[model samples]
Target: MDFEEKPFLRECKDIIEGSFGAYLNLSQQIGDLVNQHAQMVREAVSKLYSLLILTGNHSKPDTGIFMQLLKPLSESIMAIQEFREKNRASSWFNHLSAISESIGALGWVTVSPTPAPFVKEMTDAATFYTNKVLVAYKEKDKTHIDWAKAWLQFLNDLQKYIRVHHTTGLTWNSRGTPATASAGAPSAGGPPPPPPPPPADLFADPMKSGPGGDDTRSALLKELNRGTEITKGLKKITADQQTHKNPALRSSGPAPYKAPSSTSQPVVKSVAPPKPPRFELEGKKWMIEYQSGKRDLTVSDTDMSQSVNIYKCKDCLVVIKGKVNSITVDSCTKLSLVFDDIVSVVEFVNCQNIQAQSMGAVPTVNIEKTDVVEVYLNAKSLTAEIVTAKSSSVNVSVPSANGDFVEHPIPEQFKSIFNGSVFKTEPADKAA
Candidate 1:
């Protein structure tokens, strides 16, 4: 794995563990505080409105004061989401500065009873949250933002509370205590406990039956070859040993002959062969398009005993050829497959038919250009770019598009490509 992927994988593991759980607990605590404050504000607003209604005052009071107060609260929410969407490349130190500014803007909108202390607490929390996020952002750590968002939410709710009570202490959630810290925030102790390691055999070899008779094909041949050699060698060794043995002169010498102690058992050591190469999937259906002239071509599946295969990394076999009929190519690593050409031709004079099948779920095919007609499909939804053609006709019909099993007609120009190929199918069956 690359160094960069380490952090992402770590973050994914953290999520699977308990980091998300802590964030949720903290979020609820913060939401409760905010909820209480909002309720109070609503009550106050209602009472004032009632008074106006009772007095029959034709004039509206300056809601400007309330609007100004609500503005920062609303803007804070937007900023939080925007911060999350911020690219991983952005500097978190600069982020801290912006968050500080937002907190200052929010401070001016409401007056705290214990103004000095309240401001200090609010600023401290904001700075802490910002710094936490910055650290995570700079390191490309994802969990910090998740925790930050929860903290930001807590702060937002705290601000709402200040708008009402303006003096009530907003206690942090205790449930989110890190292993070392009483709160979800990191502590000054040594680094957090190392995450649990993934299973040792996570990538163990899998049992499989691939396309064609790929399963027993190689093993059968190899074992047969080994058995033949072993049998021949044993026969030769036995004949030589028998000829070298001295006949016992029982009557003349009255002696008994004994075989050598070391020769009693044959010392044969068996070692396994190296693992097979891996396969990867390239664009399975290489659309042999003919733009100006017919591009004569031939496509053929390798014989069952000698089928080709698609690979992932240069060695990891992602798909076995001949066994796989219709293949859907998606985001794949090493997007190329080695092929031993059965036949190579590029002319409109001749074409070949390749029989293929669709198994399990049909893989999704993403068509970018609309000018080309869709020949064979098994997907329920098909999207393309071309709707109309200028010189040549482009036909689009979704046989499976109507939820029916009927086969669609292949245009005269493209019938050769779709002759024996089936609709969509699962990618794992082909690739794994």
Candidate 2:
């Protein structure tokens, strides 16, 4: 019998060849964009970051004041982006000296502390001023999450420093908390503040058990179990398994206890680390799966990659250095993706917290059933159509004048009204 190509294989081959032929120039442009910009801006950003830390970092243990000192840090990132634009050809990543300065400034601070009341105020202020601080890194646009984390870290450092090194006998309080009175202060003497309340027994019963049975019936153990005793149920099954075929590794002991009435007592499986990611080129599609914690996954070849399928990855940074037919990201979380462009469409489905950047032109981008996705479109991809449905916190950042990224949220809200006889729905006009 003569061999016949299956419809699926034939369709894949046609899409690959057709996309390559149609968008070859776009592929080269994206490849150039990646190679040119990815390694150029690091040196400048590092120098700027170090200078901000050295000049703005103060030893004072006041969070509000320290956050106020971030003004210079905010201005310097904008300058770095401008410098990157001008010196794109000459700059390279360098060993920055200012890292040592940052370490020494917060050396006394060790543990994280509860945020002061002004934390919410400062956070709101930071959100208001996000336009000034967000700078474009090679393919990754710095999101508010990155900026907020830095602010929260400095706040924590200041809190810890106050706790550790502040002199005794003087109370340092947050914005709204009451300060302790210094020694020998005259009291307002009103019935001695109604006498201090007595401390409760730590192991008291909720239902008022007798004193003899209190220890055994106390709710303390149950309360602790409800919160912190998560590991008790995560015990792995110890029976000999079909997957582990080696007899030497098999356990000689009896099988571990499993609870009966499984309808009520459901077993919680122990977590095992996922296998390292694999990229297989099947026909014309690149299948990327099980990826996690990977920082620099590069697909540099322009000709070989026709399309991509990224599935079930977490906390991964994948950069495709060339244009392709299409890319589909499915069932992934916390993915940082950077690609040049696509011939057809770049689609995201059932994703969460995904941040993607397109350095070159794209025809269309689709996001469906996603949560908290940030898309950065460069000067080239400004005209790309971003079609979104059933998604939220979807923000798109495009370049504006003055070398800053202006972020705008994709409108998920709509206004429906009865226009005479029929009801019509359109995207909400926030301006109206």
Candidate 3:
């Protein structure tokens, strides 16, 4: 018989494919718009510089020139904003916001006279957004994830451009002359006087002019290179998807059994062995439990030097004690974890009904694609990434070096999610 595909998986795949296709198209359009804007600015600046050289006017270009250069940037920003509004319900909203912010920074830098700081900011934002996309891709089998990868490449290229071209327009050279002064002869007094030191706040605002600056040509080249790479990756994924087929199941041969010696020996009846108990305890060192005809396991560790890994289990529990080691949980359900002391890392993925308790030194919790129900923690610090929790009740109390438990304010993000329920720790009995 032919293999039948699961409806849910197929539906998910189709949704991902559709979303990804739309994302790819929109991202390409936005990228093209940005590139065009960059190109326009470059040409405008180059032309303006040449004209200044010919006319020997070192003053800033008329406001009309600035307005003209800014038009494309404004339009691109509007387009991105529109895209964000249209896809507000998308799973990629956070990613879209990051990309939009990066593009907005780019727009600001384009119109700014001193764009060095803004360039750096734009690069950082774009790189951050790219990293977020990568994280999403690693967590799910969504097609739009590939678009994120492409977007990142494009952002990296933009970053390169900003770094190479420190400034977008003409600036005073070290000799106090306009950089374009090379087009004319030097003064009779040997060389022109050295340019005065730049103002202390020259870089304070990216929109103002500085004495000297860099250009955008090399950065543009990098952008072009990355764009080509994005196209190639997109095409490859598309082709691979077209060629791939649903998986098929194959049958195994019949089970083997020995024939009884009928003639020589009296027939002995075969009896099936009894199944083991659902729960087993190996002294105080370990315990294992099986439920619902499947293994719902738990592993407890007391040694701080050892690491723990739990995977593909349901209704699982993990207990940790001692100094601290890393713990990783993946593809689990109804998980309950307790950390008694300091831990290097706590990572969870594709999990639900999670309950974690922390006592002593704080550990960073990295949760991805997991839904958390509760977390009770006491530590010096906690870091959560890509973690979603329905409710969090944090009672912060950090033991000082002198052994006094000092209160630390809950992080803003956690407080917001918990709706201000985070507070000072109560007595142990009361907390329970």
lDDT of 2 by residue, 347-413 (tens): 7878999999998888778887899999999998999988886788999999988768988888889
Top-TM-score candidate index:
2
**Residue 61's C-alpha lDDT in candidate 3?**
35
Task: Tell me the whole-model lDDT of each prediction, alpha carbons only.
Answer: 0.32, 0.51, 0.45
lDDT of 1 by residue, 343-368 (tens): 11100101111112222122222221
Clashing pairs in model 3?
161-219, 165-215, 166-214, 167-214, 362-379
Of the pair 2 and 3, which is ahead by lDDT? 2
lDDT, candidate 3, 1-432, per-residue tens: 101132322332233235423445545454544333333333322232233232232333333333333343355455565665565334444466556656554443334465556645665555544554555445554544666555554444443444444345332223333323223322222212222222222113353332221234445567788865757655344532432342221123334476866677686899996534333332322222223224324444456554555555567566665655555565667777776654455666566777776765544565555654455555334443323322233324445678766654323242223337766533333332
Highest lDDT: which candidate?
A: 2
- Least lDDT summed over 10 consecutive residues: which range in candidate 2? 91-100
RMSD of each: 30.2, 29.5, 26.8
Error of 1 at 84 (Å): 3.2
In order of appearance, the predictions have TM-scores of 0.16, 0.38, 0.31
Cα distance off (Å), candidate 1, residue 346: 36
